[model samples]
Target: MPGSPNVLDLVHRSCTDVAAAHAEHVKIDDAAVSALAAELLQEREDVRAAVRGLPLPIKFSSLEQELTLLALYHLLDFGSGYDPLLTKTSGGRDARETLLFGLIGLHLGGTRMDHHKLKSFTMYDLYTTFNIEATQEVAVMPGVTMTKPGPLQPHAKALLTAINESGAALEEAGAKSPGELLLSLAEGLKKAGRTTAGAFVEELIDSLPGFRDSVLYDGRTLTLHRRAQNLAADLAIVYGGRDDRFAFSDVDQLAADSGATTIAVLRAKGVLQLSEELASTIDEGSELPAGPHERALRAAAVAACDRVVAAAAAQAAGSAEAAGPAAAAAGEEGEESGAAAGAGAAAAGAAAEAGKEGAGTGAGSTGPAPFRAVDVGAFLAFLTEEGRPLHGKITRHVTRDVTGY
Candidate 1:
């Protein structure tokens, strides 16, 4: 009993701390409703419960760490948009109406670790990077102008501190591996902030190779992948395991089990392309090549080029048909008119063939052509035998850490 803190005591302490922080918070007017105040207290408990559910190891990059902290700051100030305690003083919809106060608090509270104000750092960093600051005035009507005020107030600052401390706590809990830790941290962050944290964790998880054979990471965007089991299920459908090498074979079994029609459509599109690539491989002497991935991509490219040629031919045929009727009407009275028309059509065909030949010769050609192929033998004359001169520039950008940005 001497060392134990009961649940009631813990709840009272949290309420007291939040109430004190709320009192100290500076605002233009009394906008946060009593219901919202109560909801904030409830949110704290919910987030704490969510954190406890997370796995032991919690891992995250510094950028993710920063975002996690920012998310907590938002939640503490905004209450997840659903505080039921406001049944009495309720007229407005939600806490979003009081968002400016929340923003102001976060900006003023600044960094908990460094005790650096958010306004000072964000403005200073922005100015240093882009030669612009939030305070800089922009022209308005007549004499009116505006500029950002200084750092956030005490209440907002306290919320920011709480966020940073929670992140530090998660880091201290340490997990079995970087991946496990990341997942745990993500789950914890989700309790505090919701979808924002969920998405970050999902993207990181999808990037792990043990989790998925292939991952799609579009820098500054999204990632997509299929896990090992899901992949196996798909394989089971396609060829009934008759040929295990093909990815689609796995996908086919998955389609059967899941009743998904998309697998068939995708396979149909791929087969034509595969056929083209297979033909290319056969022409080069049926070895099937060493690199499956590269071969597949090349096959797709060849199929695309064929489609382009077919489309061009169709357009040419339609154009001649449209012109033929008009030409016949214009020359119905003469015999030599038919001969002249034939000559014009032959010339147009020759021109189209020449255009295709010229286009196939360009740098933009998707892959090697059917008749004429890429001349790999002339590579030394084009590329600097050692390397390109801009290699250093590219390396710097590719390896650059832009978190500071």
Candidate 2:
């Protein structure tokens, strides 16, 4: 068995030889094909037995056998003497990727076939599913991200484009690493049965803290929460388990894990807010938000809200653009003064105004532009006077107030 050929190689060779013999004897008898098939199976078993003596023998499992059977059915459906799963109705790229991977996985000894069960898969299957050369090329690119756009044919272009654009931002943010985030986004796009925008939001979380922080703080802001819930519910329906994070834990624990001292702290930080009585009621007996994945899920809600705000801003911009010169001027002025929230260029003006009143200026401006530069430190001081605990934690000095940076 040490010198014997690999079991799979032996089986495949036997099948090929038998098929050739059957073809040669076709004129003699229909029995020839049956005989050849029987011989192939017999030889396959013999090869398996012989290989058992070797250190690197292939093993078999029922799930693997089932997949092989599926592959056989697929091939037969394609009119090949050997089963092939190709079909005209199969949506192009996804179908091709699935067919190639599925077929390869069937031949390989070990593979996790279920989509929901994301265990390790065969190297052979991986190579088949993803083109090794293309992947290698992408891997070496300056700032590339890859996403698997799923089995649907229509969204491949959009999926690729999005990964290329957003992948860089994600890498910069240090949320999820670029590779994992890219694949996650791709899977969401392909299988989550959500809009492209919804999928994009998932990508945002993997790529940007603003989105991640937003998601952790709130879930009602974007359709992403709905889409994520739909995906979670779909998984529960198909897999016979609960995937909703809210069901896993309570508000108090969720707040604690999310970096707040209490449910009250969560409310004060705008992470969670409820009426005092309701809070008390839930606190008396409510599920605790536990697990890292659950926390991420809760965070996704807030991220969705951030996306909604962004969309609203863009819509407002569009409406303003249609309103003509005055609107355009206002928009440009807003950008320079940091009225366009999160603009980095306005930081200079903001820094100047931190301790004292200062004027802002734009690229082409002759004189200093009139803008309020409030001292965030002083602002915190005033908030501290109001007895807001968050004032003490405002050392990062982010001016979330859109009136200034």
Candidate 3:
């Protein structure tokens, strides 16, 4: 199984390999990665707080409903290309938040969002549900205008395609909803002695076309599987320890959700150095078509985030080791000494385990959760969000024609 070609492995390997090969447009800076990783390590509490703040405010009637909403939310998590339009139309909510609020509104309005309901959704229904205006004014003659399909129409169409395709796949597999499908996959993987996040992702990609986020580059397939990987990570975060059904032994193996925002944050932090042409293109707010340049940026972000996690884990381990001697010496005084020694030992052990897991060995390690690339991604995402310190500095690369994000 170590050498097996799973989806997670493909994502990590292809991204790193392609990034190393295609450095002309985007270059990864090792020193910047180390510095950023150290900064994130020192701000671990902030990272955790940001991640904890991600869940929607709505209360679900059941785990099934929660899973369904989360799944649908991630499924349509794209449309960053329409972020400006979305912000203007939705009164300041970005693309991701808009989607979440829209889905929540649907649930509150008595829609179950089951596979059948998803399949039955029309374009008009989506426009209404997401609160996007259906038409835009197009200037035809001088001082005259005509109504045409809105700028967000393409994004709405893409969202519709993703949901309809996902629903069809789930229905074909005898799943009533996304939650049911995920539960079935988990149970089946457990029964087969292959209960890991990578396996879950592989199965999800195989089951749904919408999750197969890969492209052919230079005759080789470069896989990102951003939505699929995030779905697994989200499930682990939402259900870990609360429900055994979603416990993934190798949750630490997941890479960062490689998307436009991730790349932008990395670039802003100096981790990714883009060529003049690409930088101008992104800085000018132009749409980055899904091509070699865009793929290079995303792939570089994934690989750089992996390095960041590794560096952070190493720093944590070093700090723990440095404190171990003092802690052991403090244990020689009184009753509290024994507890201090035990805490030190536990901290050192956790740090070592975190280092191993952060290396991305795919060993089914259940290490300290904060040392994973997913956590690093969450931290960067939080920093770059609207009104955050890094918001004005980072220009998110926009790709309009793809639903992979």
Candidate 4:
């Protein structure tokens, strides 16, 4: 695999190249991206808190169980395109919320995270597990009624397929569960003296079919791999300090979540400019298939986020340098001022370090950190969802029957 392309490098390069190309359907605005990065830098603290607070409140019996459930949840993470239908079916819960609800239910319902059990799950089992209705009433003739597939049926089918495929693959690989598979991959990489998040992500992509979220655009393969990268980020955040297996050396190399939500947030903030046709199509709630327009939008989002991380990093370094002399001056005043300045300097140094490669908890840093592409992506997604009233209504582009996101 020496000649094989690095997945993370391909993700960054392909996205940057495509965004720079400025496809006919979508355009990335550099100024807007810079502005957004500044704003995100201002909000970096809140973003960090949100990301650190992502560990589920529920208690699992063991770390393996927790990881298995988390992996399964991410495996079934797709279905953004079915949000509206999921909302209606799940008592107003969105796609992610609905999926989380189902995951929690599965755990509480005594469903073990076994590969064989996953492969045996039927559509009906998925419906019950997600607490959605399986069939809908269809009025065929007058008062005569017949049953048809529910709105969530297709989403359920997609989930079933992903689950079965993953289960089969895991079983074939002798992995008892997704968590076991992750552990094996991590151990294998460690034995080979490779311990980067990109390595872990590539392992997942090579092992799991669902993690291969790439598309060909203009003869260039754009390796998005949104879910795989997210799983890496999540592991780094949730288990970095708690578990040695989750520590990744090069987590800063991880890109943002390459999904429609990121694209939607960028478009709403004018960081991503869309053509009249594409804008109208999305605004009208048309299904934007996986093609040129969709690829451009996602790739632009990826590139825009990379620029944001770089800008934020530069800004943090500048601030740290500016504060150095000020802190020195303050230290001359009194011991209390000196102590405060020391603390502030330490905080700034940590933030500056976060901007560099391998500067997170995964790399053994133990202080306040700065922004990364994953944090920016999460912040944008949070803005679209929780900050909707403040940021205005933002609708994610609808792409049905796709397992990428």
Clashes of 2: 21
Per-model RMSD to reference: 28.5, 32.3, 4.1, 4.5
Which candidate's lDDT is highest?
A: 3
Candidate 3 Cα lDDT to native: 0.79
Q: In candidate 3, what residue range of length 10 has the lowest lDDT sum? A: 360-369
Question: In model 1, what is the error at residue 282, expressed in angstroms?
Answer: 9.6
* Superposed Cα deviation of residue 145, candidate 3 (Å): 6.6
Per-model TM against the reference: 0.18, 0.18, 0.87, 0.86
For candidate 2, which ten residues in a row score worst on lDDT?
249-258
Each model's lDDT comes to: 0.28, 0.28, 0.79, 0.77
lDDT per residue, candidate 3, 227-333, as tens digits? 88888887776676676667788766788878877888899889999999999999999888888998888888889988887667657767678767867776776
Q: lDDT tens digits, residues 113-172, model 2?
A: 332222233333333543221121224466975544333222222222332333345445
